[model samples]
Target chain A: MSRKLNFYAGPSVLPVEVLEELQANIVDYQGNGFSLIEASHRGKVYDKVHNEAIALIKELMGISDDYSVIFLGGGATLQFSMVPMNFLVDGKVGDYTLTGTWAKKAYTDAEKIGKVHAVFDGKDKNYTTLPEASSVKPSANSAYLHLTSNETIGGLEWKHWPETGDVPLIADMSSDILSRPVPVDKFAMIYAGAQKNLGPAGATIAIIRNDLLERCGDHLTAYLNYKTHTKSNALYNTPPVFSIWGIKLVLEWIKKTGGAEAMAKRAEKKSALLYGTMAESNGFYRCPVDEKYRSTMNVVFRLPNEELEAKFLKESEEAGMLGLKGHRSVGGCRASIYNSLPEDAVSTLAQFMKEFQRKNG
Target chain B: MSRKLNFYAGPSVLPVEVLEELQANIVDYQGNGFSLIEASHRGKVYDKVHNEAIALIKELMGISDDYSVIFLGGGATLQFSMVPMNFLVDGKVGDYTLTGTWAKKAYTDAEKIGKVHAVFDGKDKNYTTLPEASSVKPSANSAYLHLTSNETIGGLEWKHWPETGDVPLIADMSSDILSRPVPVDKFAMIYAGAQKNLGPAGATIAIIRNDLLERCGDHLTAYLNYKTHTKSNALYNTPPVFSIWGIKLVLEWIKKTGGAEAMAKRAEKKSALLYGTMAESNGFYRCPVDEKYRSTMNVVFRLPNEELEAKFLKESEEAGMLGLKGHRSVGGCRASIYNSLPEDAVSTLAQFMKEFQRKNG
Candidate 1:
């Protein structure tokens, strides 16, 4: 199979090994006589897969028993609402940091739910910068301090996490989850849409400190309550079975390939290659985001002009590369080199960037 | 490959053809260089898939422009809350019929959301029977009348839909959707989890009459509001990409096999085979569900005693059968013959039932 270099932002590339394994077992999972997709979620076949996925995430991320790692449906966008619905209760205000697009969305959704405060609004800087982790503070009555670890659209990532003493620190890590060694003890909760660094699109992974689940009030509907998922081990409903199975396989791939530390190193190396190439270009390419807040996952940059950007995208597609066009909101180019995207693909792109500049610059 | 006859309930059997197609394209979709799962949800590759899935559902269900067919995540359990959160506004009460475990769960969730009333409760009959569709009536101020089209646990199904003239009629057809044709105009909304007749888990298909969107309030969170999905055509968030693609394949298979009418005939034939076997067994086997309400999708029967039931389950597995054990709530044998389950599998199960009785008796 002639597989192109995929650079899509959120539903980005996955390890070839994971895809091969999924392709091999899509029909009959380990000779259990039926595809895992068609097997009952409560049955032993899928139950094992479900638990293994949770276990691997815990082991890979070094999470403790004090936290519950639950998988839910509806991407990180759902978490934008559920995070506030479950926590912004009992007269507690939600403290949010508007670092970029996704964090702003979480804040906006929370405003519709209850009282919320934005501790740091990056909108003044057009979301091209971030607040100092040590400088940001939550309000006294804040239930939780929320932030997005990385903005896929704005191509900004937090280099360090904020310290929120008593108020729980919650993060939407959809774009950069599993791409680094995170200090799990520092945060009360972390959520991610699996399409980015985990596996596929159907599942959302949430790691909630056990204490936070107690705050999930009875007023919330069953599915909306985090307690329901934690109580049933995310089996309160028929889970995204096929998606979870795919996740289990991807997690296994992660473990076999030297775990989270290896992934972090790969991320640094891949992002540096693209950035280094841009640094060499003489005013031909420019990255809009502040260099300190530059994302390791999604590297957004611009060519000399809109015409060159259009030509670059078309040529990239013809040259066996895809998903190079930036989001419409940000009119430029983006290469999302998530955990599964090989460094070689970035090198290929970097080489292409130089060649394109030579011809046009 | 030693594939066995599978009889799982939800997340149950799927057509071999669908499985093969998925297996073939799990890595490189249509030679697009990357798997569809890896492609961006907003891009052309997945957009075509997303829209085609919606279009096919509209065509197969004979739905018109008046209805907005949308796919969402979090299953029917999420819908339980969303239905009330969106519709049970402005002092309108939701009328629910308590039929079985699933129906009761829906009712209980709505209770937390707003004022609700049980229009026709089958609890008096221990959920072994259903209310006659014509006999059931909604309260005057009812915003909508809700019913479970088929109960996967109790093995009961509504033979005819309730006629609620002014009040919107809604049905959760998670277990038996697409198994037969229905009058599309009768219900204001119909939602089903894709695990059963539609495809795999992760995607929930909702066909809502356009007017229902008007009732979705601004008070609700973005993901919680049905209007958000309708306005963006279910692309409000990064959708469950792989699951929707599978649903599209399953829909195509359904169309090729002969639409819903053909499926109805097959359901009757397959269900009759199992029921006929029980009838021939005389005092050896019993079906607890009322004959009129017996589910064609899930054929549940009890052996003469618990010991025989255990023996039947063990021997069924040894004879290359799987998922024959009933749900834990009710201890018996249940063979879920969903649309994708071949007639040959049912014929074999019937043959096994007869031979088991001959040997055990």
Candidate 2:
């Protein structure tokens, strides 16, 4: 299989070149006579890696001095627990928008640690659209507002940042980070799991407000302590070393691929191509998400039945296109065009979908 | 830089062959288009990876139904807190032998949850020998006895597993897990951070006696709950996917190289070669530890003065002998000859030491 197009939501696609770089260095790194993983995280070499990873996130997002970038473990799900644990001080609450599964997960876990106010949930509307900004009632005393910028499961996204006044906005940008140009200063904190747009599944990138870190609770364990990690800059413990290395290569890949602007343009073109194909797919293929809120990173659509979806997935797999099955929340197909999925792969997928519709419809 | 040896303790050297296999699959795995890291942990592909990783540990260890294996996040240090969290009940205490830094860490953290009996320490002797087993005073109702079988620091190791009567032995075999053969049924538990013998740093391998898991607290989080992982066979949460993948490859390498017996024989040969060279240098190069307890993995030695030690380290680095600096507790040169270090790397280091001694001594 020359280029097996992987459209899996996350633990998604990463560039073949990055892995080759890893392959070259897995036994020895940069003439160091040691695997990168074996090098000390506390040493100068790893210090550069950590600093560069943070710098790259900021560079890509074009963030300011006010925000501190943190690379972390536990993926985005851990952030679900961490956000409440850290930010929700005594008597404070967090306003969460339930856009889809990820938002719901973040909100539900938040309720266990602190008070949670559900601003708006598209759950009632079968999660087909994003919650309107007019309905979000940000409490004056709320610690912060948390939302998912792109809901991969529901194929919804916030086209515009919400107005939260003094209440800082936090966004889980796991699915769409770096896929387009995102305003760095709009959110108090933003986290994206690496599998989607960055590199692999073991690391998560966190862009956080420096001052907000002061409010993090001291009661948690050292490993779970955001304050401890924030204090030491994510070196409080032995980090996932190899995964961070992969992310470093991936960040370089992003820079070479023309930064965020070029990526955004390519992503828009790719999503437009796939969605256009789905639109012309007639009664055979249907997209459940509202057009305005559809995610540029993940294009979700459905066939008439599971059997047809199964056939589509199977035939697509045989035709060298895999991970085309949609998430369980939406029963169809989701072609996740993350940063690593070149525009050609997306076009190939679109071509395959078009041909499939031509034969089956 | 060709075939440079890795000496970064935990994320240290992996078998060179695993790197070759990893290169072939980085962008496309087994004809699957997407890179291995891009695959979902929830998907069947990763499930195969997870199974094979655990299966390899069992196969390599030659364990039976008495022991169950699981991979966890946060490395071995997390297990320092987690072992107590899961196994510490209202009335029970645990015994720990402070052989080196890791065991002391394990013992110190276990005290937070319950009672601890520190069996022995070589602090008085400046960690020159393994703490004598005769010094161990096992508690009548101790949950288990914990020991760092191979201490990467201080160059100490339990030459053999200690018998603690009715009390079960729990070993942190992080630096020595596939380096030697062991009777898996003898221990109540054995946990190793993958960076050393297994694969990468993200995953921790825990081999627990099935009956011991029943003692784990019921209220533990699903993520940290041993019972939760043991029941599902370590699929409790989205585990460290890439680490597990690498572990599978490492295990296959170990198998292809004739399993742990071959590994143990190779370790002895490499370590003996290095240690023999140290002995031949007499007072010029001094090994600080008792010869009987000297580790087969970490060979620690000192020069006549701090200047010579510094020069030795610097010149060694220039000569491609990396990670030779000793742990802070015992300041000197440390040559960590883990399973992945080919016999020639050790021979090269030994040759370098002799040449340096002839010129500098």
Candidate 3:
């Protein structure tokens, strides 16, 4: 069967190969008499899948033994709470860069736990750009610096990261993780919800440096405390067995298809093709985010009016394209082409965009 | 291909029909040209699935309009903390009945958030029996009474619920949800990890009465806040979409196969056959749990010696019967016969038991 062009922001597309693999193993995993979902997380079958998933992340990202790769549930929203619950103590300030919707929400979530400082705010520019790296700085004696590496809502991403020096750096890399090469050692911790650039929802991956485990407080509940997860290897209580297995397969696919470096090259090509078309649209179609900080994963653009935007979405859906509607918080159009999205699909979308402009411009 | 008789305690068996249905749609859900896991949670497809799952739970359990069914991630361990975070506030005593390992863990988790009272402790009896209904009582000013409906560890189940009077009652029904008929209105709230009788191991079902939403605290993080989840219909964040879809299928299966009433009858028969065989052994096999309170879900038993117990597990696995090994906390034989366990499998287990005893007697 022919697949639809999936651009829906997340619970988004997965590699066709990954989906096929999951299909093959859905009933019985490797001739095991039971389904993978029926297998115990503590059992031998899942232990291998769990370990391989962790190993693949380490290998693909060039991560050293300094980090522990963990699979968790509750998506990036839970991580928004956990990062502060673990690192931000009563006496320490947690520095945050408010780049877009997710970063702002993360900053808000942290406020419920302890003191947090928004060191930089991009909302002043309607979340169209990132903070200048030179002006960004963690507060004196701050517990950690937090930022969203990519914001799906406004189609914004940080082209350059801030230098936190001695302070630990944390990022909500939910949209951008595994889409390109990342320097694992530069940041103290990183987390991503698995729906984008990975496998599916249900699982969130956390890559935390070993030293950060010390900052986990006593008042936190067992599941809320990162130390409990780290110590138990993310199996403290049945760590989303099926989703972790799905992640393992997606990670293996990532490794086999030439690691993060290869993904970076692919992203550069895919984004350039789509962005070039938008750039040449002669203001018929306009991108909202700044050119330097535009997200390669989610491309946001707008037509002349809401009526035309509505027409664009209707025409695109009829042509077998899906999830092109922009985030409700910031409406217009968003074509989120994640790692699993083929380059040809984006080219098709660009061609469609030009045609739509000719008819509606 | 023949399926294995899965008897593992939590992350346990699902219906073979459910597995086949999942396999059929693993790649293209209803020929939509995309995997269900790849569908957007906010999209219409997932919205239908999300609503159907909640509706099925309410219908099957005979739940009234007063209760709301919410799906959350991070297993029942998260609920252990969330129960207290929402309801166990300061100046109010949260009463707990320590029936088994999980109940003890729930009590420990609640202590991290607020004042809790252990109304009854079963550890004195090695967690082999539930407190008598007459002997158990909640505090006069208790906020809510919490208990484990079924304990997977020692195979103890509450034969009669404690009288909490006007105070709210909460239960962690992780291992035995949908295995029997439950009076939903009798409890203020119920939460179950979805690895057992439900579907898979990522999503958890939270059935909270409308009034329970008021107990959610303001200081709690967004994901931890019950009110936040209830207000948004559990879509405050991108939910564990695939797991929730799987749950919808399982609940559909339960409804089609004569609902929870039929499941209760099946449990009764399966548990009787296993326990009766143990009873007829005449000291050859000894069940650890008290006769009256022995769980219909998990049947924990011991042989004359550890040597025979090892032999039992080895031979059982070789004979295509798996997960007979009891929990490590209590070293004995355990056969968990959940709702999906076929009657023939239990008969096969019984046959194995009789033959093993005859050879070793």
Ranking by lDDT: 1, 3, 2
Q: What is the interface RMSD, in angstroms, for predicted model 2?
A: 2.5
The worst-scoring run of ten residues by lDDT in candidate 3 chain A lies at A239-248
Deviation in Å, model 1, residue A49 alpha carbon: 1.0
Mark the regions of model 2 whose C-alpha exceeds 4 Å error after superposition. Answer: A23-47, A89-91, A111-117, A138-143, A165-168, A280-283, A328-330, B42-46, B91-94, B107-123, B134-144, B162-169, B215-219, B231-239, B328-330
* Error in Å for residue B238 of model 2: 4.6
lDDT of 2 by residue, A226-345 (tens): 676777888766778877888888989999889899898888899889778878877678888899988898898889888888999999889877678887656788888888887788
The whole-model C-alpha lDDT of candidate 1 against the native structure comes to: 0.92
Off by over 4 Å in 3: none
Residue A210 in model 3: lDDT: 95
By DockQ, the best candidate is: 1
Q: What tens digits encode model 3's per-residue C-alpha lDDT throughout B1-361? A: 7788888987888888888898899889889988889999888888898999998888998899998889999889999888988898768999999888899889988898889999988878888778887777889889899989999887988867777778888989998999888877889999999988898889999999998788787888888898888889899998888788888999898888889989989999999999999889998999988899999999999999999999999999998998999988788889999888889999999999999999997
By DockQ, highest first, what's the ranking?
1, 3, 2
Q: What is the interface RMSD of each candidate, in Å?
A: 0.9, 2.5, 1.0
Tell me how far the alpha carbon of residue B258 in candidate 1 is from the true structure, in angstroms, after superposition: 0.9
- Cand. 1 TM to true fold: 0.99
Measured over all alpha carbons after superposition, the RMSD of each candidate to the real structure, in angstroms, is 1.0, 3.1, 1.0
Q: Which candidate number would show the highest lDDT if scored against the true structure?
A: 1
Is 1 or 2 the stronger prediction by DockQ?
1
lDDT of 1 by residue, A1-361 (tens): 8889999887888899999899999998888778999888888888999999999999999999999999999888899899989999988899999987889889999999889999999988999999999999999999899999999999999999988898899999999989999999999999999998999889999999999888888998999999999999999999998778888888998898889899989989999999889999987989988999899999999998999999999999899898899998878999999888888899999999999999999
- Positional deviation of B233 in candidate 1, in angstroms? 1.3
